[model samples]
Target chain A: MKELEDRIRRDGTIKPGNVLKVDAFLNHQCDVALFDAMGAHWAQLFAGRQIDKILTIEASGIGIACVAARHFGNVPVVFAKKTQSINLDGDQYVSSIYSFTKQREYPVIVAKRFLQAGEHVLLIDDFLAKGNALHGLIDICKHAGVIVEGIGIAIEKGFQEGGSKLRKEGYDVKSLAIVEKMDADTGNIEFATTD
Target chain B: MKELEDRIRRDGTIKPGNVLKVDAFLNHQCDVALFDAMGAHWAQLFAGRQIDKILTIEASGIGIACVAARHFGNVPVVFAKKTQSINLDGDQYVSSIYSFTKQREYPVIVAKRFLQAGEHVLLIDDFLAKGNALHGLIDICKHAGVIVEGIGIAIEKGFQEGGSKLRKEGYDVKSLAIVEKMDADTGNIEFATTD
Candidate 1:
């Protein structure tokens, strides 16, 4: 977690709309070594827990979820696809979610056979802003009869209410690096206390 | 590679239109243990080579690339984004690619800083059919002045022209499992000889 925070501070560039660009290491260009370490951290945090699978949304979350699964006893990882491809079978468990970043609503889906009833799912993602994507995944889990064990996020915009709202509802949400505050003018990133 | 061949034969489904769906493990619902084995396999095939980074495309390729990177000495893995997002900044090397799967001409972008000149890059992907995505990533490397050491594919539709073309051109292409033919009636899959 400290390595992630340090990497974010060293390479994360602040843009106009509260955007912390970690494309250098977190998103576009990934540090697999760091990913393994983070996976170890998650394994430690979720030790002695019954996690049957790791579920995440497509694109950015896939890489993190894959590496993290190595630590979580090599559990299977199911990523909800953002778009329904022509090759994708017609039958699926679907949920609609709004992307606050893109300012649009998209349907997220997974093959019905993947997520089974009573399966304990650990939801993972790269960033949590308004919590729309996380909730969408949770909705799909609900439809599939899967239990949402907990949520694991790499970076959370703590100023936003997404993290707090989920915690208030008694959901176990774990975040590695949280940006408490950011200033574009000064290029400052304030991290939240781990506890 | 035999293990991968067995997985495809056992779990892979052949659809009507020459679609080989291995979403159960390779892409959608990822098996981390198998991914580790795959990473090790790739490492053995590309042994004694200096690989600085692993490049791949979004969605399916991320998981494979992340796991494969562990075997490549935990090299940094970079995935080109298929969609535009607010998080991706202005400074980027972009390439336009046409996806037959979705029937669209969209742009894939990588942070300009991710791929550096003179770095040895190994392109890894889930499927190599028409080789459009692989070519696009290779073009990005050309634009960025990076050296493409080789290309690693999990599965290659040998009936397609993608593999043959790359092989003709003398590119170091290694497909873990190459499917020569598939019969939906008999539920049979034939893997081509890599030797």
Candidate 2:
């Protein structure tokens, strides 16, 4: 966790409108080694919990979740597709979410056969800001009749309501790096102290 | 390679219109253990090549490329974005491609900073049908002035022109399982014999 926090401090850029650009290492260009370490940290935090599958959204979360799946005993990682494709046929659990980054609302889809009833799932994502994406994934899990074991986030914006709201709703959320405050003009950032 | 061929024969489904769906383990719901094996196989095939980065497209390719990066000494995996986002700012290498699955023309974008001139890159993808997506990635690599050491593909539809075309272009292509023929009605699949 400290390694991730440090890496974010050194490489991450604070942009206008609270936009933290970590594309250099986090999302667009991925650091698989760091992802593996984050996965190990989550495995420790969620120890003793039954995680049958790792669920994530497509594009960004796919890489991190797949790399982390190794640490989770190579569980199947089901990435919810953001758009409907001809390949995506048959019954599916669908949930819609608005992405501020993409500036549009899109449907998150997962094939129904992949998620069975009573299966324990761990949700993983790159960032947790407004929590809309996480909420959409949670909605699909509910419809699929699966049990949510825990949520693993790479970075959480502490100033935002997403992380706190999820925690208050009785979700076990473990975010490796939480940005408490960030300055666009001075390019300064602060992280929440976690034990 | 035999292991991958065996898995595809076991879990891969053949749909109408020449659609071979391996979503059960390969793309939609990923089997990371199997992916690890595929990665090891590619590492063996593309061994001795100087690969500084792993380049791939978003959604499906990210997981395979990220997991495979470990076999390449944990190289950085850079996935080209399929859509424009507010997070994607500054200079970029852009190419357009038409997706048969999505039934639309989309832009393949890679940030200019991640790719450096003369850097050796290995292109990885989940499926190589018509090679439209792979071509887009290769176009960006060309514009960025990166050297493509090799191309690693999980599955290639040998009946399609993509794999053959890329091979004809003098690329070192290593496909784990090459589907020579498939029957949708009978659900029978055959792989091209390889040495």
Candidate 3:
């Protein structure tokens, strides 16, 4: 967590509309070594817990989820596809979520067979903004009658209220880095106190 | 590769229209343990190569790429974005690729900063049908003036021209499992002889 917070401080660029561009090591260009470390930290945080499956959205979340799965005893990582292809068969649990970055509402679905009833699911993602994607994954878990173990996030936009709202809702949400405030003009970022 | 071939034979499903659905382990519901094995195999195959970065497309390709990065000494994994995001800035290398699965053509963009000139890149992906995605990635590397060390694929539809064509073109394309033939009605799959 210290490494991640430090890396974000060094590489993260504060842009207009509260955009923290940490693509150098977070999203587009991934630092798998850092991800492995983060995964180990998450495993430590969620130690002694039951995690049957790790669920995340497509694209950005898949890399982190895969590395995290390795830490979780190599559990299967099930990513909810953003689009339904003809190749995807069987019943599906779909939820419509608005993407703050893409600025569109799209359906995220997981095959019914993957998220079985009574399974403990751990939701993971790269960044948590308005919480639409996280809630969508949670909705799918609820529909499948799976138990929500907790949520693990690489970075959380603390000013956005998504992480706080989830905590208020009584979900155990763990964030590696929380951006408390950003100064776009000065290119400065302040993270929440870990202690 | 024997472990991968055996897993494919056991868990892979053959659908109509020559579709071999290995989504249970390869894509949607990913088996990270199997991926770890595949990553180790790829590391062994591409051993003693100059690989500075591991490149792949979004969604399905990210997991394998991340795991493969671990085997490649935890190299950075840069995934080309399927969409040009507002957060992505500066110069970009874009390529329009046709997807046989979705039956559409779309642009894939990689930020210019990630793929540097003189850097050696290794392209990794889930499936290779027409090689559109792989070519697009290769094009991005060429545009960035990087050296493509090799290509690693988890599964190749050998019956299709993608794998053979790339091999003919003098690219080091290593496929863990190549489906030479598939009987959709009988659910039988024949793999090409590795030796």
**Top DockQ prediction, candidate number:** 2
In angstroms, the error of model 3 at B103 is 1.9
What is the C-alpha lDDT profile of model 1 across A1-195, one tens digit per residue? 798899899988888788778887878888888888888888887778799999998888999999999888889999999887766785799999999776789999999999989999899999998899998998898899999888999999999989999899788888999999999889989999873
Model 2 spans with C-alpha error above 4 angstroms: none
* Best of the two (1, 2) by lDDT: 2
* TM-scores for chain A over all candidates: 0.97, 0.99, 0.98
Q: Rank the models by DockQ, top first.
A: 2, 3, 1
Model number with the top TM-score: 2
Model 1: CA > 4 A from native:
none
Per-residue lDDT tens digits for candidate 1, residues B1-195, read 888999998899988778888989888899888988888988888898889999999979999999889898889999999888887766788898888777898888888878889999999999999998988898899999999888999999999999889878778999999999998777888999873
> Candidate 3 DockQ category?
high
lDDT of 2 by residue, B1-195 (tens): 799888888998899999988999988999999999889989988889999999999989999999999999999999999999989999999999999999999999999999999999999999989999999999999999999999999999999999999999999888988999999999888899753
Best by lDDT: 2
Docking class of 2: high
Candidates 2 and 3, the one with greater DockQ? 2
What count of clashes does model 3 give?
Answer: 0
Better of 2 and 3 by TM-score: 2
Candidate 3 lDDT for residue A136: 96
Docking quality (DockQ) of candidate 2: 0.96
Pairs clashing within candidate 2 = none
Worst 10 residues of 3 chain A by lDDT: A186-195
